[model samples]
Target: MDKLGNDELATILKWVQDPHDRKSLSLVCKRWCKIEGFNKVSLRIFEPNSLHKFLPRFPNLLKFESSETISDTQMIFLAKTCPKIQRLNLKFDTFDASNDFGDHGLFALSKGCSNLRSVILRKRRGIRDGGVASLAKFLKNLVNLDLGFCKMITDEALETIGKMGSLRSLNLQGCCLISDLGLSFLANGILGKSLVYLVLAECDRISDVGVMELMNLRCLEELNVAECGPKVTDIGGKAIAAMESLKRLNLSWLINVSDDTVFALAEISKNLVSLDLTGCEMITGDGIRAFASHKCLCEIVLTSVNKFNANDLEELVFGCKSLEFVRVDARLRSWIPVTEQGNIFRPNCWISWRL
Candidate 1:
């Protein structure tokens, strides 16, 4: 190994995708350890106190994830050490009191990491609109941002997010405070043209009025409004279908969705590849059967569906050659034919039936 140059050794190490294997290789010799540490571009750590030690080791880190609550000091350390960071995922352990990294840490990070392209901040109660505003002030190159389960955020923060013109993906799952007006800000904001993927799952306050605004986002490819309020019905569904670029749609737990909405989706979204209709009590076999002709559809989840019988499923599989996986209610397992059950183990397609 000593005969190989550092660049060549690093190139060889690139093939070692498994972290454990890489760790073992690093222990082989002092030179290998130094090369491995120097070449490492991604790192994830669960311990908060060890941030200083690890931050200096990976000078070229482009992606970093701190599983624990990273404090303000540690965030500053990370930003200073890894100035070239492109993606950062900061998660807070709610049970741990000491993991208090609030807006101050976020401000420090935003000030130092101007080139950050993507960021995920999950379950951080300390973050509010102020932190989001801080992020918008800098991080102009950011492409994706996830604030899932950040309960403290309000609609005011979205106004700042709308200013992020480069953002392509945004997730506000479980952000209960966001209303229809906040969504309007995103739709009319500068980022609307660039935004392609959006997740509004469990944002119960959002209704058809808010969703209708999103119809203007022609570039939208994926959307998830699962578990939303009853106000999201056929009107919003039709609007969603009009998004020609949409490929993946999740309408799970939408109690008001019916056959008309499903048919609209099947007719309009020809390029759609994946769909989740789980817990849609109002959708029947007639609605789902419309998907039989969808050429690009690969995966579907129909858990707790009441309308689709064994025959409907059989016909669906026979028509959609691209169908790869189907997740259905366990009770329907016995409804499928024994011959088709044998096909479950086939390379091309399979079924997952569970409680």
Candidate 2:
């Protein structure tokens, strides 16, 4: 362990002694202060100076999750100090202003933390599209990034994000500013790269054209366009079918999908394990039958509004032997047969399948 690289040594700090002791150690000596252990420095509280003092010491830090209160000033301080930071998880109450996160703090972090892999800015308000552009400008190594419930971000942010080549998994659910225009960034441009998971649930503005553009990423594995408004149609479904790596799709509450989408899915991705078409009123028994052909499906949700008939239900009941959870009209039901015939959940039940 003593012969490890500076990167490796910093990682070892997480396993050292108590949390309080770790904090004290950073202040003990200049050698210890510069010891690549920023990520290991657990935080019960984060103030501007303390974070500023703690961050520069570690160069190998990967993830930082702040459970306590953190101000924008402190966030910028921390980001400025940590250049190699990979995953930044800021779930603080004070991270945003009254209406948005306007790239001040985020810009500082992205500028310094060029190696960022995943970032989750959950529930922080007042962030706009410009901040997204800032993120794309700096954090080039992002794999998974989520800006959930941020009202100010627009399609411009999406465009910037799509242009970043390293992006694999992205979640922009409830971001009301996005529209189909962002697809121009995700079009045939980055098709050769590997983008596995993408979620645009409840964007309201994004439609089939965006989904169609996304299909070009041949390595894409899962997609969740659930709760999107009437903008999404079967055209998106056809595009999804062409993605060979797609194993799961969530179109819940879309309310527009019909049999055509299901048929395309059935013909292409035979490896599907989870399919949610809940609240899709246009779906019928034929669609369900088409979905049933996905023998690997284990979790299915068909909720709200009338679409399918009795025959479809019966076939679905008989076919999906691997089903573990099924939702119907907001009600949760466990459908996996509990027989001794090999405990139903197929292979890996606990692992996050895809979407």
Candidate 3:
């Protein structure tokens, strides 16, 4: 095995997908370590100390992820080493405000990794507008940008993102400071025509005006505006209804959305597959009834819905034959396996209880 050519060694390494297994393989021999390094294109670093040791091994790395505590110096080192990197994710699930990685590190990355197309910086508290501005200026090829849970980002960061004309997936979820003004920048820019997936969940400042801007994204396939209350209303629903390409939508916790908006969404999105109306108290059985006409709908979640009872759900089951999964108030009545036409569920049907 050690005497094999690079192509043969790469073929053997490609069979090992799990990181732990790959590490075990690398430890077998020096030749195996070199083969593993040459074959690897993506890596997730859990320890900051391994940066210098591992980076040199994988010279052709394209994607890098680090959820551990990493400083600006380490980030700069990564960029300097992997100039061909296309994706960089530096999300920290447990935020530490004292982390020193900030604009300086990101600036270095933007300068060195010019081919960067996807960047996910979720929960990186130190990152702000200045760091992102550099990316917008240099990373013209960016396609997917996820800044979810980045409390530091505001309208200024969004302004820079709008200029990235090639962007297709944008996730700004939990960026509380961003208002309709930020969305307007995107809607009016070149990204409006290119973006396919947009997530604005918990951006409460955005209203119907901001949502209306999304109508210009004709290629949009998935939209999540969940929990954007008091501002997002039926007007936003109207705008969403106009997007014919939308397949999956989450309107959960939008208290103002009633049967009217729900019905309109059901009628318009003919190809809709998954719909979540969780905590949408205003929607009645009438709106859910309209979903029966949906030819492709497979999954429906109606948790905490007030109006629908046992009988209404039965009607829905009978009407929509394509439905493979349905989640409702299971506590309302006894749920017995129905042997209706033959089986109301597919072989893989599963029931998940919220409580």
Candidate 4:
């Protein structure tokens, strides 16, 4: 082992896929430990304050994650230590109100690590528009960004995100400040051409006017506008139905949407595979029956939707040959007989009875 060169050691280490075996090999000698650190590509730190003590050992790291409360100084140290990082996950619990990590740290990371492709800053209250602007300015190849529950982010942050041509998936769930104007920015520019997945759940400020603007996103595949307030009626729902590339859609709790929207989705959204209409009280049994002949729909969720009956569900299960999963209220168990339920189970579909 002492006769083998550094290159030979690295080659042998690459074949040792088991992490335990790799750790054992590193303990053999000081030189083996150094070689293992050089080849390391990913690291997750539980205590970020002690980052400077041992971070330099892994200079070739490509991915980094931390859920602990991190400070700006520590983040800067991490950026300077691992410049090759491509994915950064800093998601922490929403209850942490510390202002230690903010735009200064984000700017340093974005400037130092230009190769970042995926960055998840969910529930980071310190991160405002300035940090997001820095990302748009520096990280040209960034693909997936999750800014969920970042209450400080407004239309100004979205304006910068609109110019990110390489970004594909974006989550703005719980961002209450963004309105119709921000949605318009996302619909018009390079973002429309690149983005395929978008989540706007719990963003109460966005209404039908904002949703109508998203019709320009021709490449969009999955969209979630669940619990986005009552302003999103059949008008917005109809606009969503017009998008041909959509496969998965979540419109849960949009109480204003009636049978018109359901019928439209059943007729137009030819590739839709999953549909969630949970808590949509306006839609009746007729609306639930609209997707009976849908060729591509395989999963449907109707929990808390009291307007539909067991007969409507039976029709949907029997008529839709591609149906595989159906979720409905537990109250329907008494409506159908045991023999009839057995007949309904003949097809390769599972029914989830939820209370």
Best by TM-score: 4
What are the TM-scores, per candidate, against the unseen true structure? 0.86, 0.75, 0.88, 0.97
lDDT of 1: 0.87
- Alpha-carbon deviation at 76 in model 4, angstroms: 1.0
Ordered by lDDT, highest first, the candidates read: 4, 1, 3, 2
Q: What are the per-residue Cα lDDT tens digits for candidate 4 across 187-234?
A: 887999989999999999998999999999889999999999989999
Query: Considering TM-score, which of the candidate structures 1 and 4 is the better prediction for this target?
Result: 4
Taking all chains together, the TM-score of candidate 4 against the true structure is: 0.97
Alpha-carbon local distance difference test for all models: 0.87, 0.69, 0.83, 0.92
Question: How much is the lDDT of residue 351 in candidate 2?
Answer: 20
The residue pairs in collision within model 4 are none
- State the TM-score for model 2: 0.75
Evaluated with lDDT, which candidate comes out highest? 4
Minimal lDDT window, size 10, model 2: 346-355
Ten consecutive residues with minimal summed lDDT in candidate 4?
91-100
lDDT of 3 at 131: 89
RMSD of 4: 1.2
Better of 1 and 2 by lDDT: 1
Clashes of 2: 6
Clashes of each: 0, 6, 0, 0
